[model samples]
Target: MSIEVRSLSKRYGRTWAVRNLSFEVQPGRVTGFLGPNGAGKSTTMRSIVGLDRPTSGEALIGGKRYAQQPAPLREVGTLLDAKSAHRSRRAVDHLRTVAATHGISRARIEEVIGITGLESVATRRAGAFSLGMAQRLGIAVALLGDPHTLILDEPVNGLDPEGVTWIRELLGSLAAEGRTVFLSSHLLAELALVAEQVVIIGRGELIADAPIAALTAETERVRVRTGQLEQLLRLLAADGVQATSLTPDTADIVGLPVDDMARRAAASGIVLLEIAPIHRTLEEAYSELTREAVEYRAGLTEQDAS
Candidate 1:
């Protein structure tokens, strides 16, 4: 199964949520859906699941629109929100109700309960369950029909460390089984670890669609440090490279390759104490991408006044 979003746009009154977004989530891998809060991540997920209508454009699963799919729950399992179930409904009962709608059997329900490790609280009502437990229950419901594709929105938001690891393994295994797994998360570190590809959005517009490795490579801003700070800065300045001084003896240099820096240092007899190149962390890359798209940029005028 695959998910394809083609110029998907949505609006609420005067507020344009998502704008001409487009991307493809191929089968057999975990694709991270990334954006800052109010970047339309949730709204996009909702539109894909038909929980909300797109003002224009289309979202398709397996080459068919979600609305046109018969037995959508069986083909495309979605967890748009963890708290969609009734507070008073038992964990098992909640799944069973969704199952009943699809005429799924009791045996399948039990299987999903076990898969999600909800056996202990299978009979407990949702109101008393922890956020992690509710997340698991929601996942159980999604997996009840053994869907070929899964879409999760902020799935690891409230999970404990253990729960996070569990979900990681679960998603990895599902992808290994050749299922399409689309995960939307704010946990950039975790996403970097697990996702093979990423789709980035900002203010409902698609920002990037690429493999994780490629995106990281394209955005990599290397950090360099040298001991002969004054001499190094002068040399780099002549080459038009900007360097930030961290200490009298150490400076972080950028805009030049490591090999070039080493040669230059050696020529100047400026024995480099440290010439390390720093790669951008997933968190750093995500922060940089979405900072401009934030609903309101904090400290903007204050910084200007200063």
Candidate 2:
């Protein structure tokens, strides 16, 4: 299944929560939906699953609106809230209740319980379950239908380290089976590890929608350490190449690969001790992408922490 968000927008009275956003989540891949706080990520996800009606445009699954699906859960499984189960219901009973409406077999429910590692807490009441257990239960619910598309929001919000690793691998395997997995999380590093494509929105608008490799590649730079750092920087400035000094003996150059930098240095008679590409982490890339779009600004800085 494929997800298509075409010109999607949502409004809350006088405030516009989302505005003219557009992106697609392809099948057989994991796509990360990212945004700063109050950037309308929740609103978009809600619109996608028909929980909230959009003020304009549409959110579609396989070219049809979610409401058009015969068995919505089986077509697009969602985990919008971990606390969605009835408070007094046993975890296993809750799964059965949900599955009953969709005609899911008891065997399938049991299989999903094992798949989400909820077999240990299968009979526990949801009211007494910890947040992590609730998350697992919610995942079990999403998987009960064997859906083709998985739309999960903050799926690892309360998971332990092991649970986190397990969910990461599970998502990868699901996409490998040609499922469409669209998820939102604040865990940028983990998203970078699992998601092949990223759709980032900011201030209720589409900011970037690209492959992870392409975004990180756009930010790649070269670090050159040399006794003649100053001279090389001066030459780069004269030649219209941008470079920033990171240390007394090293300068970071952008817009040029390491081989190109080495060639330039050799042509200029600059002695270099080290020259290597600096790859930006997904966190760094996200910070840069959403810097101007964050609604809440913090007073604390790195200097203050240091």
Number of the top candidate by TM-score?
Answer: 2
Candidate 1 lDDT by residue in tens digits, 1-306: 799999999999998889888898999999999876677888888888888899999899998988898998899988977988899999989998999989999999999999999999999999998889989998998898899999998789789998899999999999999999998987889999899999988877887888888766642234555566787788779877777777788666768888888898899888877777777777776777777876646654322100
lDDT for model 2, on a 0 to 1 scale? Answer: 0.89
RMSD values, in order shown: 4.2, 4.1
Off by over 4 Å in 2: 231-238, 263-273, 299-306
Pairs that clash in candidate 2? none
How would you encode candidate 2's per-residue C-alpha lDDT over 1-306 as one tens digit per residue?
Answer: 689999998888988899999999999999999988888998999999999999999999998999999998788889999998999999999999999999999999999999999888899899899888999999999998999999998999999999999999999999999999999999999899999999998989999999998888764588899999988888777656788888899888887668877888899899999988889888888899999988776763322000
